[model samples]
Target: MEIFFTILILTLMVSLSGVAARIIPFQIPLPLVQIAMGALLAWPTFGLHVDFDPELFLVLFIPPLLFADGWKTPTSEFLNHGREIIGLALVLVLITVVGIGYLIYWLVPGIPLLAAFALAAVLSPTDAVALSGIVGEGRIPKKIMAILQGEALMNDASGLVSLKFAVAVAMGTMVFTVSGATIEFLKVAIGGLLAGIAICWIYGKSLRLLSRWSGDDPATQTVLLLLLPFASYLIAEHLGVSGILAAVAAGMTITRSGIIRQAPLAMRLRANSVWQMLEFVFNGMVFLLLGLQLPAILETSVTQVEVDPNVDLWMLFVSVVLIYAALMIVRFGWLWTMQLISRRLLTKRPMEFSAYTLRDLLIASFAGVRGAITLAGVLSIPLYLTNGDAFPARYELVFLATGVILFSLLVGVIVLPVLLRGMPRMDKTAQRHELQMARAVMAGSAIESLYKMEERLTADVEENIDADLLKEISSRVIGNLRRRVDGKEDLDRSLLAESLERRFRVTALRAERAEVYHLRATQKISNETMQKLLHDLDLLESLLVEKEE
Candidate 1:
């Protein structure tokens, strides 16, 4: 009962966050609002103190979110910016781990380098989800956003892997060596990617069999689709590899899968709706949970500071500021170096992705905002050493990491808007043109298909059927397609007419949906009938919305 109640409460909070975000007078990111709401719930009067199980949190939340990101990312863009992504996700993570790791050790008197490296590792992976939430969609240039998203996806694995090595060394379980770490990293990374790809491949085959056996069952397929990330993560972990990368790989792989391309329209619609809801809830829950933990984390840190005369709370905060500054500096410097290198060494002409203006560099630097993954990784640090003693500077590490995450978010919220202020909203003119061209082509082909169907039906149906009626219906359908292909002075008017027609149909469909719901409420219609009607309405609405976008 408690578990169910908790779930309902969190879901309510998630919904309210959305409403509240829109209701407020000024603009604020949805994640921040959700986090604030969570903090409110943790007030002393309410006294919500949910246990934070790091392992469970990672397993329950991380995979699906990462998978969704991978699935949404453009495969072609990802490939094109592969070099930039590697520089950020791979090489930069190593740099942060070593440089910031040492900085943490030097700045904080008691913490060891290994423990510091662990903190650095967790901090290295930026949260692209949080970035998008903070910096509104279409606010950043397409190319930049693509690289950032790809970097975020790949860095989760790299950062976490680096943390694993740091932890192992800190715990005295393994001796760290360059050659050994390199070999191990490759094996784990490559194996995890392969694991995810292999799992998804098998899933595609299984889904095909299911389709053959029982026909298109969207519910079953959607449920299976939902399980893909978890399956990839668990299986990869069991095989001794990076589960994070495995989940990401599975998402990316599934996007390129043939099954989805040939999937039934109903299945695609249902799956899209399900994934959208899950992404919203999962993302809200992550930030909300972090907010919930904020009070406790602060209280505990204060207590720890009081307990140890050597540990000053003020200095701890200062350490957080310093560390975050170092991160920005490192990010900016690295990005600038890339730009310089690309200009001087790579080519006389600036590389499209590698070259950047000062403003662009700042945007990229700040956009490297940290969120859920850092929270998960930092929290996942083992509480005790092998000999049962407490892990050194665990409390300090947590405090600093949490502080950095918050600081980074706040800074991003402040700086990103200003950086992006004057930048024109990404021009979608070319995209609109392409979409129009594709629609014209599809409509032409559809007309041909319709004519073929008409011919086949002429012989198959009763010969006594009204020939003029058939002709009129076929003519009406073809007329719509004909408008798509017609190129003349009237093209603009034709588009306007189509747009207006779409709007009218959408409005009517919505009215019908309301009526159906009203009927269901009045017991004039069965719930099943209402649901079917609603589904049809929703499908039509989705099409209209897609066309408008």
Candidate 2:
């Protein structure tokens, strides 16, 4: 009962924080605000302490978040930026581990090299949630967004694998050998990848079977979709592979297979709403949990410092600052070096080379804000090694990890906006123009198909089909396409008129949707009937909006 109330209170807090973020006049990021709330709640005076179970956190939160991100990511864009993403996700992660590992080892006395590397691995991956919060519908280039997202998705596997190796060495489970560790890492990573692909394939086939059996039942479909990420994670982990990567692969498979496109409209709509809510709640809870764990982290750090004469708290603080600085410096340096090399080698690929710029490099550097993954990795560290002795520098590493996360959040909130200030917003006009042109081409193709259908029809069937209605529909479509394509004064006027009509229709549909909700609230309509009507209105509104755009 106590745990149930605590959870309810936390959920209320999350909801209020979300509301406050929207209504508050300040420009502070929502995650930062939520973290502050969490800190306050966890303060000794409040007596609302919450212990973070790292395993539970990872199993419950990470897979769904990663899966959602992967599902939403544009497959074509992901492929286009594949090389750059690999460099950032895999190569950059390894470099951060090696470069910062040695630096931390040198700076902090009594911390083993493997432990230092473990800390580095924990901080290497950029988090999608943090990135989304910082970027928040801002005008950052699409390419930059794609790269950031892709890096965040893929780096989890690399970073976690490195952490696994480092932990083995730290715990005396395995001796560190460069060649041996490299081989193990490859085996683990490749195995995880293959496992994820196989699992996704099986899941996809199962979904198809379920769809056939269930016959477009949105509730059944949505429930099955919800189970997918967890299933993938659990299956991969059981196979001793990267569950994070498995979740990601499962999501990408769903996207690639066009399952989302094939799903019934109601199922897609309901699933989207459910996923969005889940993302909001899970991400909110993560930061709040971070806050709740702060007191414990600080107490541990203090206890460790008191017990060890050589452990200077002030020096540890300095090391934290230095570690953060090294992260930024190394990230920036690598990005610049990669761009330089790519420009030279990919001379013929002007499209690829031309996208790299100083502004983008800076955005990418600052965008490396660590979040849930770092928290999960650091907190998951066992207190005792295999030999039953306390794990060396565990408290110090957790404290440092927390410090890095806070610093990154502060920088993201304060620095990122300033960097993005002068950048041009995405060109809606150009995008709409391209969409219109594509529609015209598609309409032209449709007309050809209609003519073929007419040729196939018997005379009696053709008579019953209403030739005048068909002719009118085709003529109207052709006229609209010509007006859009020609872009002359009269045609432009016609296009504008059509757009205005669509805008008016969309507005009316929105009003109707509101009225339907009001009826439901007033109990004038049954819930089922209201939902069915609302769904229809939503579909109509969406179609109108798309056409207008």
Candidate 3:
């Protein structure tokens, strides 16, 4: 317990420190860098060793990360791309599993096809952390990123479900009949979906009721929202269903019906900040822990296993590497075929997202780096088979998983970016064209408003003076319109103008609250102090709102 706390403290300090920014030069992602740091610490000479309960890692990290991702995802966008997201999440996973399973079995020959299938299943899902890092801040097209994120989110459930089935087959705990497997799959999948919706609905309604009377304490609201994900997960898992799917479903439900749809502006902002912070810390820990576990995993293997000097570890290593390539190749093939189908039938004219050419296919292929879900499933593999005998190839399976992660990180992160660079760049002219299209939309609305005003004031106008005012208004409107349409007014600058205006007001309110906090933190602040401070905060908040207008 002491060791665990120490490691946690170190991880927290490293993540919160800005030192990582100086470590990487070429737009390397923070997660990847953190993992590298962990690997470095795990080296024999470095002598920093950390061990974690795999179960604890899941309990601590996975739920919040999944929930945060689910909550922030725009439901409307996800719904619009539901078909494509489902295709990638469900169908693509199966394709990688079968394809990689066959390849590994063929290459290794010693490992059973079923064991290979289990490995493949573990490697099928993509990492949300990896995807988010690679595609930063809507740098990619919103629709494309939405599909990627949505797929990554759902695939955690689908891949984990598939993994449990693979493990069952491995352990031979459950009899494998085609009909029985089908029924089991339905039970888990359908059960998860139903459980998620039910819990989310109830929880969301509960939140609405609570918020109505809770005085909207931002910290309190944030804490309740954080608990909802874990509670939903626990309930579903306890009921022998997919906790992951339940979490996903509940998140979607809450966002759709609770906060995004109904919460006040301040509440939404508060919730967003809370989720973002949780996401940051959770990701930092994941990569840090991932790195820290490397040495321990090696030490455990060396200590537990009796080594045969003649055993061909190289053969196993080579075979797993080949299998990793096969997984990626299969992913690419599936994505390409899907993209071809979508292009021909569904999407009419897709534009490039970011500097990448063939954005959809490349994003689909490169985005398949497996992480936490895969690691969890692999680590959860039972130690003994159904016959009360030792499980086959257990340690080798762990090595194989570690190999997959390393290979994916090395190849996917390093190679994919290079591949994407070759794609066409959307230059200044193209961006200007998009801006013009947006301005046209705003102008059309403004013109409609003017038409309504002209209709109402036609009879009330005393000819000359009224005509002059109308002309001046029209000219002013046209200038604003042309400034936007012709790209004469910088979009970023214009947005900054509004942002600065809002920021000033929010700063003043925050200052008043900060003074209250200072008083409380330094000593005992009385109820009088609290009440007066709140009154000032309330006035400042009103001023802030007025400034927003």
Top candidate, metric TM-score: 1
Give the distance in Å from residue 270's predicted Cα in candidate 2 to where it truly belongs.
2.2
RMSD of each: 2.5, 3.2, 7.5
lDDT winner between 2 and 3, please give it.
2
Q: Rank the candidates by lDDT, best first.
A: 1, 2, 3
Task: Tell me the TM-score of each prediction against the true structure.
Answer: 0.94, 0.90, 0.76
Any idea how many clashes model 1 has? 0
Question: Candidate 2: where are CA atoms >4 Å away?
Answer: 346-355, 451-495, 510-531, 542-549
Candidate lDDT (C-alpha), each: 0.89, 0.84, 0.71
lDDT of 3 by residue, 214-299 (tens): 86656666677788888878888899988887888878777677455576666667677678777777787777767777676666
Clashes of each: 0, 0, 1
Tens-place lDDT digits, model 1, residues 92-129: 99999999999999999778889999999999999998
lDDT of 2 by residue, 1-549 (tens): 988988987898889987878788877778888888898898889889776889999999999999998888887888888888888998999999999999999998888888999999999989868877766864677878878899999999899889999998888788989899788877777777677678777876776788789887889888988988998899889988889988888888888887788778778888988998988898898888988898888888998899888788898888878898899999999888788877777777633424667888888899899999999999988999987999888888999999999999898888888889978888876666666667656766766776676555535563676677767776776666665545433444545766887888988998998999899999999999998998788788877876764
Superposition TM-score, candidate 3 onto the true structure: 0.76
Model 3 stretches astray by more than 4 angstroms:
1-4, 13-18, 23-27, 43-50, 212-219, 260-269, 299-311, 342-360, 422-549
Superposition error at 253 for model 2 (Å): 1.6
The residue-level lDDT of candidate 3 at 467 comes to: 71
